[model samples]
Target: MCLLLRLWPVLSLLLLAACDQNQVFEKNADFDSYTWTVQEKPAFEFEIQDTTQRYNISFNVRNASMYGYYNLYVKHQLFGPDGKPISALLHQMILMDPQTGEPRGKGTGDIYDHQFVALRNQQFRQPGTYKIVLEQYMRQDQLPGIMAVGVRVAKAENK
Candidate 1:
């Protein structure tokens, strides 16, 4: 009974994850030194079998509460399976409240996790693997207090 009780939380989490039918791909890259450098670009590749389905793409960030800036700048590039660029943009994500300096998203003590939508209701041109590359675009060559970065692609709900 005690073992089953302990396993209840894990089972609940697994059930929750299994209920996410729209999630297509999700991946995260961790920085061992808790720093993101200009040269360290994380790339995520996901296969799309349905070109007609619209999807939403989000960028995930995990940072320490002591992160220097209130906002984090990042460059995102999307490429098709043919390795041709589909879209590129420089996006700014707010990590904290500008006035109050309070952290955003879910937090556990000093660490916080954030997911910002980068693309919404986007449809793919072809049915193949697509790639997204993320780069830290801060002024400094090395951005501190960033623990991990990730990407999530999900099927958009019809409106």
Candidate 2:
């Protein structure tokens, strides 16, 4: 009885941490060479069952400290379930501080993880599977130090 009581707090915390009620979909695409090439485009498909709920879309990036540029550029396109393009844009994510060259986002040792918001309070028009494609948009043919890229869709909290 004493041991169970002592472990109750720890068990409660673990249970709470496992709950992510807002998460709809999250997936990552890893690069074997730790390099992202312009020709390599990663696409993610997720189903939208509820059109009334607003969602927040984010891009996840994991890079090494050796990444050459302070900012990463990419082009993202969203396609509806009917295979029609909905929106497309070129976005920039800051990975490091420009002046001090300090790496941004969550990091341990040399690796850093960044989550940049692509869309907030977004609602789907239709109920089906939607696709989002990400393409590296850089001057170089290949970008080094980029380990993986991912997409996350979650329910937006009402303010």
Candidate 3:
């Protein structure tokens, strides 16, 4: 009984952390029944010094198994307070399978995982305001896949 009591608190904390940190994106406000298209283009815009650094965008997919393929992109210019774009960024995301033995482009007449994506700064130019876009191209729209993408603002490398 004593051991159980001690473990109870630990278990409770673990569960709470899992639920809280499991995702960064909220989907209820975003559509969940949309078909093979972006119901809404969700992106984050922020500014940073023009220097070299490695930036990473992490996306949380609610229905990871509901899609066959996924792709990510960035806007040419970021949204500004004046309701205009400030700069353009060419960043792309490459998705990877989280499921065991699940290959990419799977269920789309290929042998691969449902979808996966990742990106690095080397593939893009100097730091500036930008927009990240997530696109879906797949079959079976039973469950709408949810995604939350995060970008790290760092300096661009010196030439």
lDDT of 2: 0.87
* Candidate 1 vs 3: which has more lDDT: 1
TM-score per model over all chains = 0.89, 0.88, 0.37
Off by over 4 Å in 2: 1-18
For residues 1-159, what per-residue lDDT tens digits would candidate 2 score against the true structure? 766653453354346436978888887898878999888999999999999999999998988788899999989999999999999999999999999999987756677778899999989999999999999998998989998899989899998
Per-residue lDDT tens digits for candidate 3, residues 43-136, read 6555533334544333333223444444434332344444554444554434444455343432222212212223334323444545544443
The residue-level lDDT of candidate 1 at 69 comes to 95
TM-score of 1: 0.89
Taking all chains together, the TM-score of candidate 2 against the true structure is: 0.88
Question: By descending lDDT, how would the candidates be arranged?
Answer: 1, 2, 3
Candidate 3 overall lDDT versus native: 0.38
- The number of residue pairs in model 3 that clash at the backbone is 19
lDDT of each: 0.88, 0.87, 0.38
Model 1 agreement with the true structure over 50-125: per-residue lDDT tens digits: 9889999999898888789999999999999999999999999999999999998675567777889999998999
